[model samples]
Target: MPDSVSPPRTIIVTGGAGFIGSALVRHLVAHTAHEVVTLDKLTYAGDERALAEVAAHPRHHFERVDICDGEALRAAFVRREPDAVFHLAAESHVDRSIEAPAEFVQTNIAGTATLLDVIREWIDGPYAAARSDFRLVHVSTDEVYGSLPLESETRFDEGTAYDPHSPYAASKAASDHLVRAWAHTYGLPAILTHSTNNYGPWQYPEKLIPVVVLRALAGESIPVYGEGANVRDWMHVDDHVRALVAVLERGRLGRTYDIGARGELTNLSVVRDICWLLNELVPAGSGGSYERLITFVDDRPGHDLRYATDPGRAERELGWRAEIPWDEGLRATVQWFVDHRAWSVERLRRR
Candidate 1:
């Protein structure tokens, strides 16, 4: 394959103010030479400060729009006429999904379908003449494959069957299928990826690592579900962002890639590691150790036992790999949460 260089093109990133979406947006602005548009609903999960650096950059723009809002989505699509659209907007928190499965279905499933409808219309009408190489990168999660036994060595690959166990996973799975159907039925060009758990700076404290760090800092009990035996492969947000870039740049349309770092750890182990790290970073409290705050709670309903991903295809096809080691990434993440404890606390309070 020969490379034909083109002018710097504009791309749209849905949920661009979100944890992973903002990471991707920042990477695109700082590293790549393309114009970036962030389309987000600015929901409770969205934090504009996350993209403070790029928010006003000449190459970046922000759109306060919801994917499920057809008129707004269509209007943005028509105005931007983006060369690529990275769909990362969704209700991602599993607990929130459990509490409000309807919201998950609305945002993750119905929102995706609406997005696809807009994209399909654009591709067939305006986009056909605007650019010859338009792509849709549908970001997904490994949870869609459900769980593997904690004792098993199996990991989800591109071919893994969909066995989503939770409302969140089920919603994402439906969205993934919608993307595929749009590609096959309507001739939409799309690529999908299922990645492992991601952690890093600017992540909302609702997740495990941040929750542990924040709770421990507040001298509150760090709740651990069940025995915290659930296992997950944790990849740094930067690594996941890099993989998304590669997928958008070189991935074949209609192919699904599995992105992960091979950094698997039990939930309890992850919590304990965060506890120990916080102890090293923020030991100014009257407490002896942060681990003492650990509290076991009932397991979540429909919780999967484990999730891991095999990135063989991604590595072989796109030449991308996870660069952040767990130890280095974990320490940095814990340090970030400690440094920004006030911000994390505020987010929790607002929630």
Candidate 2:
């Protein structure tokens, strides 16, 4: 809401077709004057349909290029000459990472390194004149902090130490370290943000909330891990993109910000909330609620007990706050999947 993003700037948004990335792209197109070039490899989790809203916009563009392809990355950087880059490309699922840690390391770690090096060389060689104003906003996950005690009052802050337990988290942590190293050693202008679980429309069905909504509609048993007591802090994707925009504009170089909405709940509670919401929106079975489909399964290997983060630093410094309330956002998300059930179900089937 600060009058326009002021003085239009061209930006490159990596992974712009994925859930959070698409939302950010849409937000930029609709709310700001910045010209956006979406750079995505269109992985299994990415879908161009998510960008339908902005597909024809005059300021919107798309390039099907992989970050790991260094020459292609270099070409794209030279072609776009972007003033800013929001790096959101990564292999981001914990279960998928567990099943194939190599893919995660390759995409999340190697891909990040390739992109960082391209940007570094761009700044040092061809784009040095624009270096003073260029910014690279690297979006990352809070899972990199590992787990916290379920009943504890502690929350990860900006200064929290790295303790990644899963392949996905470890890969992101490594990428974070690389970014810092580039900043320190190569004088890259960059900032990093660690955010909690993000949920909203267009998320891949494999995620918790989408899985619950999609599977319940298919009459499949909804699975929860262990007693379903594991907790997570949820942040609506819209609010997240807004935070990303704020950080791109106002964040300090070489700083890390912890982003969370403070909407903490047990896994079981999130499942139940979705079930009851479905009961109201599109009652699944004979009058009985969808909760009947809930079945607790064995917990994931090395699963963290709980995950939460304190966003005090982001709020205090950026003058940004999560606008959507948790319950309202969750309910809206359930309805969105239900409303788009055909698309959701098809995506799940293919997955």
lDDT tens digits, residues 226-250, model 1?
Answer: 9999998999999999999888888
Cα error of candidate 1 at position 13, Å: 0.2
lDDT of 2 by residue, 1-351 (tens): 553555899999999999999999999999999999999999888999999989999999999999999999999988988988999999999999999999888988999999999999998888898797889999999998899999899999888889999999999999999899999999999999999999999999889998899888888899999999999999999989989998998899989988999989999999999998888888765638888899989999999998989999999998899989988999999999988889877876776
User: What lDDT is reached at residue 320 by model 1?
Assistant: 90
lDDT of 1 at 51: 95
**Alpha carbon lDDT at 303, candidate 2:** 90
Give candidate 1's total backbone clashes.
0
Top candidate (lDDT): 2
lDDT of 2 at 178: 89
Estimate the Cα RMSD of every predicted model relative to the unseen true structure: 2.3, 1.1
lDDT of each: 0.91, 0.92
